[model samples]
Target: MQRPWVVATLFCLNAAAAGASPANLLPVAQKLPITPDNFCLGAQNVLKTAKQVLTDELAVLCTGNTATTLFKNLIAAPYAGTGTPALTQVFAPRADNNARTSEIMVAFAMRIPKTAVNTLLVEEKHAIVPYDSEAQPPPLGNQLANMKMSFQFMEPPKNEGDADTTFALQQTVDTRSVAVNFKDVSNHELRQYILHPDNFDFFMAGRTLVAPTEQFKKSVVVRGFMTDPADATKTLVVTVAHFLMNSRDQHEQLVLAFSNFLTTDVSKLYQEQIKP
Candidate 1:
């Protein structure tokens, strides 16, 4: 079921409102394929629905993002679709223990079913991809970070799975700031990995897990796929991420990197794999 809480962060990006929509003005998602055709998921569900993965120990300041602001500001003007995606980044300084909240709400156009798309996501991600989305087809061993689930690399997804199901992603991330040395680094702990799948919608959320020092590592990712109203034949794959970066100065670089990761990289691989 595409519950109100499914696309927790993405539900707020749409503009069309049914007559029953409340006038309160937080962000209200319009009727779309993934969303119930005639009703709203309600503003209360936007930006605040809590999940078990975001545990109590996560940093208070580190956990928050600019979802409300972006949602509110986007609707200030008319929105036809999830147009160019709204984004914002803010850093909580010493008072809040130096946490930077960087987030983005973007969408990709695809000609595929939500289930197919999501399955590809989990499948492609779970395999090895030394670099991009396309993992060399069969010799998967070579690209698999030496078969490590939690490594100091953004290579590709890997997991310890069984015949029917897979477990959480015990993966590490590159946390060193560009402000620091220019080499690649992955000194952080494992990340929070969650994949909430529905037959008609695609929504997955994950982040870096807390470290041995009990430091905050809950950087969140929220994504879903919905039908494009403008072109019913196509789907609108939306991604909303709230990452805790090292510094606010890394905003530009982060944006560029995320943009590539958000659309170009995965989309290209998706298209290529579907060919006969």
Candidate 2:
């Protein structure tokens, strides 16, 4: 016969467990099995139906490569003056992978060359990448400067019985031209980390974004996975919801217009390095 208080506690615990949603009870990050199916499922949960604002998805096939190598290469790639629009600076406060949490700062330009824009439509299957042929150059208009982004990666709590890790990213975009008023944005992503055969998987759930104005907020889930499609070849799949949050409607529209060009230019930069 249990004491009265003990009986009440047990009843409450059982009730809570029965009422909890799957999203509220994520699996332990360290215990998750490393596999593509699991990775994809994790990615899908990043943004639940109730909180999603905008999303998109892209799948790129590498002729021959494994997911493990692809993950390593992506994180190891030089952060500065690389990729499309060019990353000017990347700094990490905690460099070790074993650390419980890390902070990173990334600076990049947000301009796309005309040459890159022309090639985007021809190569990409997804329609989310936006393009504008008549866009003006920097100083005249259309160029965002000093896009400084900061990211914080936090692992699950060691003693709290928590089971999720997260990444928080914040950035402010200032354009060269005053006519364009784009506000800063913050992305907070809850994700699971899994070690795959030759790669790693970061499956996200519940990504919330707060626009500069604070009043306009949006939630999205993003899935990013990299693996080898075949021997010596690597592939990556990135998916996001169709909705997006922004400071203003115009800002969202402008970003969509140039999304394609920016993505293409960045991809080209990476391809150039891997070309034999």
Candidate 3:
């Protein structure tokens, strides 16, 4: 059964202490090895390494399990609302003291049935208006589907302000279910949704190998995928794994490692599939 909710208010004698509340960032963050010159370079390296580790980790996790799923490449797209697609070589997940933050990464994964996924395509548009807290903006685009969109800020669990935020895009399609979340802030209001029908063609084209590697500290793990290894016969099924970033270092490491691993001749990490 769905749980119910209640509204509560507490009167605190020490109002100053309550005023120090911090924004809740999700996942975790750690100290990362980064320098201006090597920021993007280091992120790519970390992404490559993390992909390998994730593969191994999945093999162990799925062992003795009958999930039998194919794995695909994890793609991080440019944020919809702000920041365009730009390539930067520097590698810190945290923004410099005085620079506009790099575009947020819209990481996605496509899973295929036993039949096979010939192509992968993901198309998302920028939200027309930012989400509003005081004022409830009308529902976004009204394209409800059985998909979900989730986001988590990279903050250490030890920090009082650390929590994973999730939202489901209420799309109209599929035999599956859908979920959504909404939020509003000063500069921009935001809403994230999962659309119906996983488009495989767009991703397999290899136009954009991976997300831009800027302000991506190697200390946090952005995300990973688990898929069946490509073979001559049959098809590969895949599942994407999401990891919480507790520190800037983890994020930096994941971007660098995943980028290098994806843009290589490595079959274990990623390979072209026969278009269906």
Top-TM-score structure, candidate number? 1
* lDDT by candidate, in order shown: 0.32, 0.32, 0.22
Question: How well does candidate 3 score on lDDT at residue 122?
Answer: 13
- Name model 1 segments beyond 4 Å from true: 1-166, 170-179, 182-216, 227-234, 248-276
Residue-level lDDT of model 1, residues 179-248, one tens digit each, is 4222232332222222222122323333333332222233444333334444433444333344444434
Q: What is the clash tally of candidate 3? A: 81
lDDT of model number 3: 0.22
| TM, every model | 0.39, 0.37, 0.19
- Candidate 2 lDDT, tens digit per residue, 170-263? 4333333333444454444343322221122232333445442342233343334433223112333332322233323344333433343344
How do all the candidates rank in terms of TM-score, highest first? 1, 2, 3
- Number of clashing pairs per prediction, in order: 2, 30, 81
Error of 2 at 200 (Å): 5.5
By summed lDDT, which 10 consecutive residues of candidate 3 come out lowest? 1-10
